[model samples]
Target: MLDARGLVIVFGLALGASACGGDDSSSGGGTGGASGSGGAVGGSGGGATGGTSGAGGGTGGASGSGGAGGGSGTGGSAGSGGAPCFDAKRLWFEDFETGDYSRWTSKTYDKNWNNGFCHDNGFSTAQANSPTHSHRSEITCADTQSHRGYGGLQFAGDSVVPAYTNQGSGIDAPNGVVNTYWSWLEAPYAFQNGKWFSFWTVNNDCGWKDNVITLGLEDTSNKLTPAHIKNTGGTVTFAPNAPGFPMGKWVRTTIYINYHEGVMVTWQDGTKVFEATFSRPDNDICQWHWGAYASGDNDDVVLYEDDNSIWKLGQKWTNFDVEPYFGVTQAVCSP
Candidate 1:
């Protein structure tokens, strides 16, 4: 509990003396005016009249001015700060538990690994028919291959691999592929026109590898692509090479969309890295996906993702009773 209190003191002092002391009677034949003492009678033998003495100086008035009022002091309340508040009804996935699949979809090639291609069960695989699975593996680099890694569905876990086998895509072409790191975000269905929001992070290859994060806006007419779309204009790329960027570490990425403005801001750890606004309207509203595609087959290239979560802006976490999959609150500070 906290309390506040105020204290005040007032004081006043007078500066001048009162005018109450004055003589009135005269001695002999002379009369004296107000404040003067009468003198003794002149040399006459007769007894001289008594002179009145001036009244004593009036007492001086009291001393200095009134004092001022004092200010109040208050004690601040105690509580936790930076706790993340998420919408329980709107959560897509937590603790890698799949609630529904109709809301998400994925893109896969039948048998074509054109870039250092291999259907070698290492990269992409499905998690237990459930929306979430324990899928974790690294894509290693190779010398002759242009694109060394395979893209796959990532789930929640510190480090655990699902017990599924990866199907092969036999179109291995080293030169046609490039080396890069990226991730994917799958949604059961298309997001509403003005109600979709998503956030995630992508890990870079330390050196020589170009890592990027993409928000697949399947809706071609909606606005939100101008700030991210490159010359080819297919998908918006959040890259680490941008100027004033704090590169070489994990960076947090955010996407906010509505009618007025489609803004994208990326932060390194917790500090802002880059912000971009798109002039063109984005209309894509299909299932979203995040992953990597490279130019050469350098199997060593990889991307890491964690703390993947989403929420509608202005929504509070307490309104819903849904718990996080891991049994812990996913609410986190902006770090």
Candidate 2:
């Protein structure tokens, strides 16, 4: 089993020391300490020290209904409250409404580590946010293997850094985010489980094994508590034991990463949950993985993801400027 330290070394070697710049060197950005102590909305985690909290957009208006023929796998017009199910212009998007797993493949860096997922059927037509189907991520603890799922772009060596440009410029680049959205639905577990569902990492071998910040939930006293994990030299847990990930319901999370400012802010179900400064603007985003990256303990786990999208604002902007476009405006769907 690859421990946290093992993973960090793997990533550091892959990306090289120079690619990472420096660790724990955050200047400016975090304010009012680390927020998200209470379980209430808008009170979740704060940004890194010296960095001010990028004010978050409030829970958007009412949830919009899915379009009449949104499952066609094509961009359709918005219904009442929701945006189109698909947008060809987006940097990338995956709704699984096509009833297949064609948009995903093995990890762009380490194919074997992906555990043969997405090669076969992994969709449930009944449980989805846009009506038809959603990707299902399952893990058998007895197998003692980690599970990983990919969405968005399959980033590679040369494709990483150049995907977005004009960092810190007040104008937008083609790949910069106007808003990026992803979500997870926790299926009822027969036993308590620890599962890391989202990972953004970089490495030289394209292995994506280092400096991973994971957003996942752990079952405590029969309730799932939200947590953001930073696994660099070791494992550090932020926003621990905070209540937000509700049981058996879809929790949509929005992420705003100011590559220019080296800051990241995350919101869950329209509430700000996590913010941090980890990488500099020069560091490239090597890989993005969403699934059971780390299967903690021996417990069966199942999760669902849908309506994953990356929408570029068409010009460069900071987290503070994009506050108006963040949060979950669509109606919450259940599994």
Candidate 3:
């Protein structure tokens, strides 16, 4: 998002286009040598009386040229150019149900389900340590309840219950508001693991606030088992341009992580959003839990969720491509 200062710069550039000046004309030729300048001023030569230039017929005053067309006004710069398009392969979660866990290894830790406050039936809840919020509760899974059946990973308000009273602390809240969301795959996870991914959203007293989708990978390591972990954070805030984002409605969020040397680029809704490079190797030991962690009350929570599919890492785009075909045309008969 652009800050106030950037807006000022943009406005200044826009004003520069009007700086061109208008035109001015030089005085026309003096009324020719006043007919008496020469010796025989016979009748001032009628038409030539103004001067030897024959009065130049007043030159019709040069028709006042039409303002040079204002140089076409520069067209206002085309509105930031549309986002580039890229080919995407859809990876569904249902594929994992048939024992295709070869590409993905679910972090096999048990989540001690919470029986309090009526847990949403859709989420696989758990408790875990959050880097930013310290320890918090979280939820994970897709929202199958929606007609589109897209996946989503979420964190609940109760997870950060302790920090609720610690509001206004810059260390935890940048906007001075209490927020609960997803924990991204940090350093240790990215260095050792090959792929890390998640889908999440932010909710508060205002209802469904916005969405932030992420995906990353980690390498193998001595300190951890999985080797590496990485992910991306792409946020879609509440604004007019962001369509299909419903307040209190389930929006489908997805992420695909592409790992490159030192850099990982993540795509949300088929568009690239986050890119970062790592200085040290990041790897983890297990396939992390989705809902809640085994030991803490701070777990990731999700609502309006479903888990009908699973996809593996390292699968090529071709694995999910569906080719289009045209059948033979039928002939029509007329009376």
Candidate 4:
């Protein structure tokens, strides 16, 4: 579900922590069972360091509506087709139903970086993406520092995903790789500025760490800082972080790299919150890492990932706009 190695290269932000149990989630949208209780253990702050400043609280708008009470609700629209798929061959698929990390160990996405499963820090099937026997990937950060060795399950594309070099070339033109992280659980310690995690696309083929985005908390605002896509001439749209990004919910993010159109689209919870035209010449994508990374030490931070969360987006799905706001399973994608 993650390419942890690419995270280190991109933002030095580590992806980690236990399941978040997305509290305050509604029945139709956002993951449930996120009571923020039970197996929800607070990570040890490593007696060696002091506590973090933590995040400032954010408020959501009220749902009080002034409408015609007599009017009946309109029929809901039909949904998109197909379940989440990865790659043209579906070889990168992993639901973890077998309860193992064999898909990662079976073949390294790029051995030039690391090899085998980084089971030292470890990942297992503890959290459930769904109560009906569906499980999620609970990735633990290294007890020490940045887990560069092998903390992710990389899914290599036939050609780089989202075609890194050229905008209109390859799958990135129409079909880009999509990965969603159900931060269904987050320990209290994960609220610091040093908190960083890479969710999707990071170029492992070469060392172009520009558009490679990483999730983190902005020290000043204490909001989750979304990743930015960069071009050749030190160009980047320094946008503000989303108000309540990783606060114990499944934040669905989609990255659409359009070199031809000269635009890069970032969708959060199914909204086109950020868009930028790249001045760079070309773009190439290699892998997607669903694990953890850290700016400082791995500490006790541990992030959760749903086994069925990773997805492949057919070109048209990108234009769905906010259709996916209903959360993961309910949101439809083109086959």
Please give the RMSD to the true structure for each candidate, in Å: 44.3, 12.9, 36.6, 15.3
Worst 10 residues of 4 by lDDT: 53-62
Ranking by TM-score: 2, 4, 1, 3
TM-score result, candidate 2: 0.52
How do the predictions measure up, each by TM-score? 0.33, 0.52, 0.25, 0.50
Regions more than 4 Å wrong, model 4? 1-77, 80-92, 105-125, 131-145, 149-177, 190-195, 204-211, 220-224, 228-241, 259-262, 271-273, 279-281, 308-335
- Which should have the higher lDDT, number 2 or number 4? 2
Q: What does candidate 3's lDDT look like per residue over 251-333, in tens digits?
A: 22232222222332322222233333332222211011121111111123222221211112221332111110000010111
Lowest summed lDDT window (length 10), candidate 1: 1-10
- Candidate 4 Cα deviation (angstroms), residue 277: 4.0
What candidate 1 gets wrong by more than 4 Å, as runs, is: 1-91, 94-104, 107-134, 137-260, 297-299, 314-335
The lDDT per prediction is 0.20, 0.32, 0.16, 0.30
List the candidate numbers ranked by lDDT, top first.
2, 4, 1, 3
Model 3: per-residue Cα lDDT at residue 280: 22
lDDT of 2 by residue, 233-321 (tens): 22232344434555566666555554444455555544555455544224444333343332333234445555554433334433331
